[model samples]
Structure formats: C-alpha cells, structure tokens
Target: MTQQPTNESRLERGKRALAEIDGEAGHNVVAALADIAPDFATYLFEFPFGDIYCRPGLDLRSREISTIAALTAMGNASPQLKVHIEAGLNVGLTREEITEIIMQMAVYAGFPAALNGLFAAKEVFARRG
Candidate 1:
C-alpha cells in the first residue's frame, strides 16, 4: 500500500511549486498581485501551482500545453494567456509548436479567440527575442 504524503502549509507548497515551474515568472506574477490582494495572490500560488499543477499524472510540459489551450479558448485572458505562452516555452515548447496550437484553436474557439491568442503568443515571442 502507498503511504499518504504529509501535508505542508499552502504557501510553502506554493513556493516549492513556483520554483519548480518557473521561478522568475511565478515571482513576477505574485509580485504583481501583492499590491492589490495578497490573499488572492496566495491562492493563485497555492491552488494552481501547489495543488493542481504539482499533481503526478501530467508532466509540466503537457500541463502547460493544456493551460495554453484553455486560456486561448477563454478569449479574455490575454495577459494570463501570454504568461502561459511563455511558460509553455519554459517547459520546452517551441515557438512553432505553440503557434500551431493557437492556430488549431481557431477551429473550435473561433477566429477571434484564436487570433487574440496568436497575438498574445506573438508578443511573448517578440519579448523573448
């Protein structure tokens, strides 16, 4: 039988996940959140990174792809979408692959959403370059 892992404090777990995911980017996100709602910032780190993202089933690269797709579909999460595009690259996705995924979204998410996602991705790529 498998032993259950001991629980850690939310912020502690979040810190670990943030480091593993992409330290600089995660810190930047949290820092931006700090001035407005520190509690929500904590939740952002704790839930997404600490709990869901750290789950064992999917690898980080796969998770980033799924996140990119979901954010693209949402159509209104441009800032968050751009962050995930960069995160996708951090997890080893190539610019070509990321662009392909965004283009694929046009079929289901419509041209508007796909176009916005592509633009967000373009900005991320441009910034990186």
Candidate 2:
C-alpha cells in the first residue's frame, strides 16, 4: 500500500502553496490558516501549488491573469471571478492591463461576460480603495 502523508509533509505542502501564491509567504498566512483547518492550507499547497501550479512554463502572475480571463469567459461566475481578479491584482497585474484583457474578452466571450468582468473589476478596485 502507498504511504499516507505525515503531519510534517502536510505542513510542508502548506508552506509551498503560500510561497507559490505570493512568491514569498509571510508569517501571517501560516499563522492564520494554522489556526483554522491546517489541512486546508496543506491541500492548497500540495494540490494547487505543488501539483498544479508547479507545472512548467507559465509563471504565477500569468496564471493568475489567465485564470481571470477564463473565468470571465465562462460567465455566470461573477462572484468567483471577482475573487480571482483580486488575486490577479495581488499577483501584480496592473489595473489598465487587466481592463484591456477584459475588454478584449468581449470579442469572443460576448458582451454579457465582459460586462460582468468589468463589474467584478470595479468591485475589486473599490475594495482595494
């Protein structure tokens, strides 16, 4: 049988996830998440960062921006996409650049999706301010 992960392995995964997200994780993230479901943080690191995000080619910022575009194209995902848009910003995407990307989506993803994306961006901007 395959070996199960130890608690240490889980924490390592968690740390890796945070690193992938911010490129440099702060103590606050681990301290906060560790207070809640420690496993959740680990899974974020193990699956999202270590497994999926660790894949070759795309940098984290590109991944964040691309995810924003895809979620906007999908539509009916304003709330979730809004979160991702904020994540894009956290990853260093400029407002103008994100706006241009959203606008460009209109051609293929349709006006409704683009509109929702714009609204989401507005929410992110407002929240940031």
CA RMSD of each candidate after superposition: 3.3, 6.7
Question: Which is the leading candidate under lDDT?
Answer: 1
Candidate 1, 20-125: lDDT as tens digits:
6665777898898888989998898789877787778788889988989999988999988988888888878899999998998899999999999999999999
Top candidate when judged by TM-score against the true structure: 1
**What are the per-residue Cα lDDT tens digits for candidate 2 across 14-111?**
45545545533233444578877777766666676555555667876788778888988998888657666666776778889889888888998999
Model 2 regions lying over 4 Å from their true place: 1-11, 18-45
Candidate 2 TM-score versus the reference: 0.68
Give model 1 RMSD, 1 decimal: 3.3
Q: Name model 1 segments beyond 4 Å from true.
A: 1-8
